[model samples]
Target: MEQERLVLEVDVRVAQPRAPRRGGVELDPIDRDLEYTGSLLTLLDPLGLLGGVTVVALSLTHGAFFLALKTTGTIREDARRLGTTLGAVTAVLAVVTLGWLGLLTGSAWSWATTVVAAVALLAAVAANARGREGWAFTGTAVTAAATVATYFLALFPDVMPTTLDGGRSLTIANASSSPMTLQIMTWAAAVFTPIVLLYTGYTYYAFRRRIGTQHIPEPVAVG
Candidate 1:
């Protein structure tokens, strides 16, 4: 009876769940919650507005040039029409984005400005479709420049509040990385950016003329 009791006790102890081991420190649930909240805040941050503006501008310029090339030949009439349609759509999007920014800033003339910009974009697309590269480039350039300017204007006001608090200041200041990181980034830019720019320029120069059926290489026959 004593031996059976001892075996039972050992089995019970072996089956028991172990407690979690303690670390040096444990985060409070509130702190963990706040960390998650901070991550969400960063994802929705408006401080990276300039990055968005740069993407839009670069997209506009590259899209216009590529469309112009694709639409230059009579054999691809549908392609030309599609290009024009895409251009018009992008232009309208640009106008809407501009108006959205203006509205956020409490501009009374937002609607009017948006309408005018949209109309100008439509006209520009039509002109570009009719082989007016200059008009198309001008419209794209204007829209891109305006978008960039508006982004900066909106961003500055948001960052510059009347009263400054430690939390607010920290949020704004820590939004960007350290100065040494930025300096290294600048050094990388100096090293690689010009090379990329030169190669891009060379590609543009090499394919400057309008593409035609001749440019499409003949397909090889499979044995």
Candidate 2:
């Protein structure tokens, strides 16, 4: 929504394309210089609203699956049951939204990723039904990854598409920074990513045990 408000809703096209793409950006017709002009909408349209709802539903379903996988006793049981229900709802919404995107974009890669997403979601639901929380979690994770891939594939060269005018869309070629900046960013990621990953792994390893109500201390009596 923010992207729509800030970039997508308005026409940000230049008369000519940018010069000298040193960062290997695949230039398309949508690749133009930024010069914002036109109005912005206070809210998204009906289809955009539906997309937002689908996104929220997906997040809720993902959370339910995570809870089912992590906790124990009543929480786990409740989460497992809820995850199944939410999964069904998410699947329906996902089909509608993703199908619309596939039709709109008409990209073969997007269609392939959409199929993967559907299969992963179904697998997650099935795993949850059989009380295989670990597999269920993995399935949901894969579903999420596939869904994101589908969206990106659908987007293709365009990073931010314009509903106002197709030609006004922001392409990766227009959005990319200079080669020097990208190289610095690459080195920065290489240096810092492993440290972040190590910290995350250590945190998970330290608190890996599953907890239930039994682990919670009783409230102290107030005098």
Candidate 3:
């Protein structure tokens, strides 16, 4: 009888639900939270790409204007040729970098892209150092445009992918924010964007003149 009773007690104890342990560290919860945060952070990169693209476009347009202002009726044909060649080379390098990033995700591609971009960038630096101002400016403009395009192309899928699941995912995540918060952010941007544009325009206009040995003022005497 005691043996049967002991067996019954063991069975009852085995069938009872016990409270989960508190301290051993579960991986699933941590992994899930990390994944959620990572997705949120990924959205920022696309916005950053868009911002960079806008800046590059502005710089290129302003730079062309600056060049025209500085060299009006004075630029040699050779300088124009050099500038065009430099721009073309830099643009090609930029396109290669963009394609490399989009198609290749491995270490070899990464290294190759880095080496090519570095070479092109170094060439531009050397040209500028040699007083090839037009070439330098053209290279800068092309490089910036390429970089912006590459980043945008990579990040666009994260922000707004073609896949239905991706769109739904972003929608859910984005909609989690409060309506009042969204409204405030929208209003703030509306108020500040024009101010930013005006300030940027003013800065470009103020610095439009070219730096030349003759134009540089002598250092003021100091006590």
Per-residue alpha-carbon lDDT of model 2 for 1-223, expressed as tens digits?
A: 8988767445555443342221222122332345443324313344456678887887887888778777899999999999999999989988988887777674988999999999999998999999998888888789889988988999989786653333477778877999999999999999999999999999878877877889999999999
lDDT for each residue of candidate 3 in 3-81, tens digit (9 for 90 to 100): 9999999999788532221122111111212223223333344333544454554355335433543553344333444
Q: Evaluate model 2: give its TM-score.
A: 0.78
Highest TM-score against the true fold, candidate: 2
Clash numbers, per candidate? 0, 0, 0
Minimal lDDT window, size 10, model 3: 24-33
lDDT of 1: 0.54
lDDT of 1 by residue, 1-223 (tens): 9999999999997885322111211111112112221223333334235336535644655365455654456644654565576675576456545655565552434444445555656666777688676676566556555555555555453342222112232134644679999899999999999999999999978876667777789999999
Candidate 3, clashing residue pairs?
none
Q: Rank the candidates by TM-score, best first.
A: 2, 1, 3
Q: After superposition, how far is residue 214 of candidate 1 from its true place, in Å?
A: 3.3
lDDT of 3 at 2: 100
Computed on alpha carbons, the lDDT of every model, listed in order, comes to: 0.54, 0.77, 0.48
Query: Tell me, what's the RMSD of every candidate?
Result: 12.5, 9.6, 13.9
